[model samples]
Target chain A: MRASLKSFTPLILFLGLVVLLAFGLKTDPRKVPSPLVGKPAPRFSLPALQDPNRTVSNADLAGKLSLVNVWASWCVSCRAEHAELMRLSREEEDLQILGLNWKDDVVAATRMLRVYGDPYRVSAFDPDNQVGIHWGVYGAPETFVVDFEGTIRYKHIGPIDRTVWEQDLLPLIQAIRKTTNGHE
Target chain B: MNTNPAAPLVSVICEIFNRILIPIAPLRAILLTALLAVSTASAYTLEAFAFEDPAQAAAFRELIEELRCLVCQNESLAGSQAELAQDLREEVYRRFRAGEGRDEIVDFLVARYGDFVLYDPPLKPSTYLLWFGPFLLITVSTFFLIRTLLHKRQSPDSALSPREHEQLRELLDPHGSDRDGRNGPDQDKSDRER
Candidate 1:
């Protein structure tokens, strides 16, 4: 009984430590809840990267299908999902792609644009994240597809991969473009 | 066709009661559901509870936010609607409104409940790990973190200096002493420190 009692002590302590470690450690996702779904996209008029005079807002792209991709140069997932954005540009002529860059300096974002083949028609800068917060974004690399009427149709979190493009994103664009939303 | 004043009067009264009472019942039900939903949206209080005064009720709500619902170890009392959290919130409110000072309330809880009552406890030698473990763990992890990350470092010796590692380890085990390592002191120092 004494020997068995001695052997059981180590197992108990090991189990105890494992429980303590698991309970103590806390991980933060640093993500915001998706708020734009089933609502109108927040309106903004940001100057285009190259064409400083040309400002794009929610109103400018009304009555046309637009894809707004929220990304940052620092986001690893954005790098992972860049190729798919390029693919979307190739396949869909009517689906205009816009980049809403969050918290990224011009130089780094410009570098990312160069590397990723600039699928964005125009990239907007969100320094100090005021625009991002107004849009209610936590971390970057989120995507929203707005219909011609300025109502948001879909939100894609993380990267725009092949499966999502086929399953959800493509179907939404095909349906929204059919709506009577043509702005000359 | 013979007109009857008595029959017409009875029918008019029936119609009047239906118009008033039937609509009001549905309206009351709708209002009741709306109130429940709004209350449920902040459902971290867990249980149906009440305080003696408005002040105790408000403070209890804040205190619950700080406490970890034991059932949902990751969630605070304010963030969880678990039954245990509900019961705990009620307990906290009961004590707070009863004119107990903060320390007395907490001590009574600690005496019966153990160290899980407070979200952040005092930093004694015994609870040093609990209070400072996050920072220490982050620091030690930072060193190993830097090493794993900086395999591209200029010098191998620059893989977090020994002093840095010791400090990191000390931080990780906030309640640790030289005599006993890792978890709060073993039997020898547990008595002395705790």
Candidate 2:
């Protein structure tokens, strides 16, 4: 029995290595877990994208479950996610979708919103990317789920389609809503 | 040597180097220009933030060097030109100008971007494997290797037994004395013919 176990040692080690490597290969290296989750959302005050005269801030998102989406007109994936956002806006009345227009030309951003459809309840224009840096936004189309208390509940990197909305975001939102209602 | 398939190609290369390449003034000038361009390009200036105190400037330089650029994973904040990297550099500069200490600034970035923002990851429970994995592997491999060597040393002797030795002697020298009269392997054919 001792010899048999000894003989299988190499095979066992190889299998362990294979499993570890397979898991690593399946994971996306670009998706770094945000430390901002479970913490209060970063403070920011920027002019609204549609109306430059009006300002939007985190205070506006208070007392509502918010979806803060980091997007740019130049980002192709955001364009892909735009229709979904519109659909989500129409569907979920309680869920506030706040757009963060990051490091983009104002004219182009406005044009894209006009051409497609503006899904955001209020879009904050971050032309200098000062607010984006504070929010730890590395790429475009990153979505953050903020609870009614303005605490970031979850951060989803990459574009959100229907599958992502259903599989990941929807469940998390439901869970947060349940807990918040229970507390209330 | 002349029949070698690669001989002609080698000779052509040698001929080109001796004649066209070595004597070409414009080619040399172009190569010199390229070298100068690379050297000048490599000399980067951190002119965006200027501090009155040289120590503060040095600190700023050191801090950015230690910070990792998220967009380009392998590059330091000082070297990266990606939009996010630029924004991060500006943020670091802003923090320095605000009179925040290096540790405070690092903590601020770590809070936002996680520990990935720092080139040197902190010693923590999650990073224990990363910090000590090499030493553990070395210790394990050394233990196994020593055990193998000691086990090999303790193995039974491989010398032939007395009975086997006797059998080998008999096979080599069947006839104990005057073995010349015996039919040798090559001489067996001659003996058969006779």
Predicted model with the maximum lDDT: 2
Kindly report which residue stretches of model 2 are placed more than 4 angstroms away from their true locations once superposed: B1-44, B157-194
lDDT of 2 by residue, B1-194 (tens): 47899999999999998899788978889999999999777555698689999999999999999999988989999998777888888888988999999999999899999999899999999999999999999999999999999988999568899999977886888563235466666567766889
* Candidate 1 residue-wise lDDT, B102-161, digit = tens: 677666555433455457866789888877888997998799768866865654554788
Candidate 2 C-alpha error for residue B99, in Å: 2.1
Question: Comparing to the true complex, what docking class would candidate 2 get?
Answer: medium
The candidate scoring highest on TM-score is 2
Query: What is candidate 2's CA lDDT for residue A55?
Result: 89
Stretches > 4 Å off in candidate 1: A1-33, A179-184, B1-194
lDDT agreement with native, every candidate: 0.71, 0.91
TM-score of chain A of 2: 0.96
Q: Write the per-residue lDDT of candidate 2 for residues A1-184, one digit (tens) a residue.
A: 9999999999999999999999999998889899999999999999999899998998887999999999999999999999999999999988989999999999999999999999999899998988988898999999999999999989999999999999999999999889989998
Question: Which clashing pairs does model 2 show?
Answer: none
